[model samples]
Target: MNTTITSNGLPVLPQAKGNQNAQAQASQPATEAAPAAKADDSVKLTESARALTAAQGDKAPAIDTKRVEQIRAAIADGSYRVDAGKIADGLISMEGQLNGKP
Candidate 1:
């Protein structure tokens, strides 16, 4: 049996071919088999996966352009007033949501 030294300098132990095995396998020369063909590699997505990919591609932006334009116009006309109480309420609600509270 041939032994090869590993990276840590320890010799690799050969697999035990016990005498209990059938004689035919033992008599045969140990030859390497051909590796699998790389060109045959292929991908197959399920119907749900394809639908999900299409749905992701078809997604719309979360920001509403019309509302944004309105807000921008209000700010430019000096009519945009900051409601501190409303902003504080929104922040508290957000904190509650983040902390998993109702």
Candidate 2:
């Protein structure tokens, strides 16, 4: 049997006469037949995943709100200072780590 694709990219298959009649009968269900039951979906977590979730609990990582407020206040008063040397050192450290250096 040959398969053809339409302009819309859907695969079109040549159906047999018996198959077409069966599909039509299936489309129009019997009046005595009951409706299909709804299925309940659920997620099953691995042992390691469940353990990690239990360890973390419901709380998120703690943030230094006081330090954040202090930084905001400093910026507002034009007293905030940027340590270029410290930033450069950190970048150099990251590069060294990425290169597999101690």
Candidate 3:
């Protein structure tokens, strides 16, 4: 009598096995590393980004002081019409946009 082993019963190829082991190792968290230092670095990077943005300066034209004073006076006299609902809606929309919501 003769017996033969099947190909499916054989072990996985060395390269394929190595790749699988590498992927499993990569999935594990590097918890032993200093997380506090990483958090501090993130904070510093955010501050640097803010400083760069501020250094770019404003792109739009400056508001006229005379017009601003006129508008303030009108509001103080209760003559300027204000839409509270529109302001609220605008603020809500802005908040959603800032939070990355559609």
Candidate 4:
């Protein structure tokens, strides 16, 4: 078997003649002998996947637009306050949650 080096510098061994013929036949246009070959292909979604697909059509998650606008206005007016203690506490809480703590 002749070995070929791909662009990624990996060696690829030649396929068997029988396997090559089978692959070539599969790639060819549908013939009278294989009319149902492509038609038989199927996909089945899991329950969670179906639920996610159904949820995609529902209303989006809740967003506090009023609070967002207030924050934007404060930022534009140079009046937005940054509470370092609150930010630090939030980070610590997040770390605790990540570590499986209540």
Candidate 4: regions farther than 4 A off: 1-61
What does the lDDT read for residue 78 in candidate 1?
48
Q: Name the regions of candidate 2 deviating beyond 4 angstroms.
A: 1-61
Angstrom error at residue 99, model 4: 1.0
Which regions of candidate 3 fall more than 4 Å away from where they truly are? 1-61
Clashing pairs in 4: none
**What is the C-alpha lDDT profile of model 3 across 28-90, one tens digit per residue?**
433332222222333245887778767777954576989977876665444556689999999
Q: For residues 5-87, write the lDDT of model 1, one tens digit per residue.
A: 33364433323234224553454445443343354556799999888777888484477979977876665554556789999
Model 1, which residues run further than 4 Å from truth? 1-62
Specify the poorest-scoring 10-residue window by lDDT in model 4. 30-39
Tell me the lDDT of candidate 1.
Answer: 0.61
Per-residue lDDT of model 2, residues 6-95, tens digit only: 336443443323434554555443433222223353469999988987798876466797997787666555456788999999999999
Give candidate 4's total backbone clashes. 0
> Residue pairs in steric clash, candidate 2?
none
Model 1 pairs in collision: none
Please report the TM-score between candidate 2 and the true structure: 0.41
What Cα-based lDDT does every candidate model obtain? Answer: 0.61, 0.61, 0.56, 0.61
Candidate order (lDDT): 2, 4, 1, 3
Cα shift from native, residue 95, model 3 (Å): 1.6
Error at 10, model 3, angstroms: 88
